[model samples]
Target: MDSKIPQIIRKSFIKEIIKKHSNIKVQSGVIDLLSECTTVSVSYISTICNAICNRKGKKAIGDEEVIEVLSKMDNEFILNMFEELRK
Candidate 1:
């Protein structure tokens, strides 16, 4: 991950996805799709705040954990839902 990737930008990206989808049922599919495109996981996304703040490596995160975190932050549930679709 590049240090240049700003937190606000990441948050905005998530917000945009949520705005477009807004459905929790869609997370699994979205995640799968994303997995095919990148090495990011549900745990990475779920702990995004902590990872960003501490600059954690991608290898340390897991997909299921990210899903769990997303579940709690439904304010942008679509971002989480997209996780499943990624596959």
Candidate 2:
């Protein structure tokens, strides 16, 4: 997350957690997942989310789609999860 999380870790998380979850095929869920996880930083989350949504960094054309999805996901489950944690 800093300037040094290493590409390997990013790839692993994307492949393991982000990609494996079928419902997460929804673009915004990826952002919610990354943000709620905490140990990773938002900058790192953004990179991973973008990579996953774009599909291996080849589909830059979907950038707008990705933004729309992120806006929807950021509030739904992510805020709920944080509230539960606070309790």
lDDT winner:
2
Q: Candidate 2 on 1-87: residue-level lDDT in tens?
A: 665454446545665775566554546555556545654555555676676767755655354544444455675665555556657
Backbone clash pairs for candidate 2 read none
True lDDT of residue 34, candidate 2:
58
Model 2 C-alpha lDDT versus the unseen true structure: 0.57
Cα lDDT for residue 72, candidate 2 = 59
Worst 10 residues of 2 by lDDT: 61-70
The candidate that wins on TM-score is: 2
Candidate 1 lDDT by residue in tens digits, 9-53: 554565567768786444645644554434355345645746643
